[model samples]
Target: MSKVVLVTGGSSGIGKAIGEFLQNKGFVVYGTSRNPSNYKNSKFPLVALDVTKSNSITQCVEEVLIRTSRIDVLINNAGAGITGPIEEIPEEEIKRNFETNFFGPLNVIKAILPEMRKQGSGIIINITSIAGYMGLPYRGIYSASKGALELITEAYRMELKPFNIDMVNVAPGDFATNIASGRYHAPAKEDSPYHPNYANVLKMMDDHVDDGSDPKQMAQAILRIINTSKPKIHYKVGAFMQKFSIVLKRILPDNIYEKLLMNHYKL
Candidate 1:
């Protein structure tokens, strides 16, 4: 029997690509979305899942387990984007961002880790973002949420090692996706003072997405990770520039790195 794989946010974008690729590779792939009805003509099964809700997550796992009898890999790919000047971003907006980007994956982990532990083997992949490594100009909240998820992935990797389970964080740079359509824009009003700068930064972000790496490439990277016997704790998927940015952030002087980031976004 092929290994069963469960992926959240699989109705579109990177999640959808991963599901399709895994299914083509002969993995028993089950993909989830908030609305399954619209995920038409899918090659893999589409299940309804709301990762932010504990009951919803639990039920989704149960549904996958009922159909496949086992879930060998669980990929948490559901996330939301937020943009605005940090000082102007509302507290509720920040919380909402964390609810989707950070807590969502953690909730899924809580729901599925027990079963993996019982089986004594499994893999958990949390789809984070390259921005998680450093705070971005207008995407501070989104960055923080992903950064928190990445740290959690690291902690779980150590904690779950003994159980023969692995947890990894895949941090992709900007990817060709519709995530910008649903992104939360904290109140940067026309006369809000930070408008022009924030608007410029938003435009820069949009351009990056327009020129972002292909999601299919990310899917292939994920397949490589899945095929490995002992996958690395962190996977960075994107163009050389994007991957190099992470390395630059680590080795460069703090002020110099911040300057480069600010220049890149024209902040």
Candidate 2:
């Protein structure tokens, strides 16, 4: 039987691309959306899911298992983005971002672990961000959330190793998707001290997404990981600079790397 793949947040963007690509490749693909009815034209079946909600996560996993009887691959792609000066962003919004980007994926994995354990095999891929490798101005909250997930996956990999279960992180740079429309932007108040820089950075961020690489590239990277016999713990997909930025951070001194980032963002 073809592998059964479950992609959270798969209704659109990178998740949608992965689902469609996998389905075309002969895998049984199921995507998730908060409102399944909204995606009547989605290429693969979309099940209802609100990643931040535990009950919704449970229901979605159960529904998929009922139909497929097994889930060979779990793609924790559901995430939310937030942008604002760390001090300016409301505490609640930061928490909410973590709830979606971090906790949500954990819950989904929890729900699916038992079945995968029963089958004696499974692969879990967490869709993180290149920004997670380093903090970016006005996007601290988003960076922190995704970065936390990256670390968590490292721990999970070792724990699941004996069970023959694999977990990896696939961090993508900007991709042309509707993520900008869905992201929560802390209002840039004209009277606030950060208004000018924050506003400029926000615009730059959106433009980057608008000009980002095709989501299909992410899908292809994912397909490669799924097919590999022993996948690496972390994979990055993006332009040369974006992926290289991570390498530079590792080799460069703290102050120098910070300077490079400041120059890039014009901060």
Which one is best on lDDT? Answer: 2
Compared with the true structure, what per-residue lDDT tens digits does model 2 show for residues 34-148? Answer: 9999999999999999989989999999999999999999999999989988998889999999999999999999999999999999999999999999989999989999999
- Worst 10 contiguous positions by lDDT, candidate 1: 186-195
Clashing pairs in 2: none
Candidate 2 global TM-score: 0.99
What TM-score would every model get versus the actual structure?
0.97, 0.99
Go through the candidates in order and give each one's C-alpha lDDT.
0.90, 0.95
Worst lDDT run of 10 residues, candidate 2, spans 81-90
For model 2, the local distance difference test gives 0.95
- Candidate 1 has a TM-score of 0.97
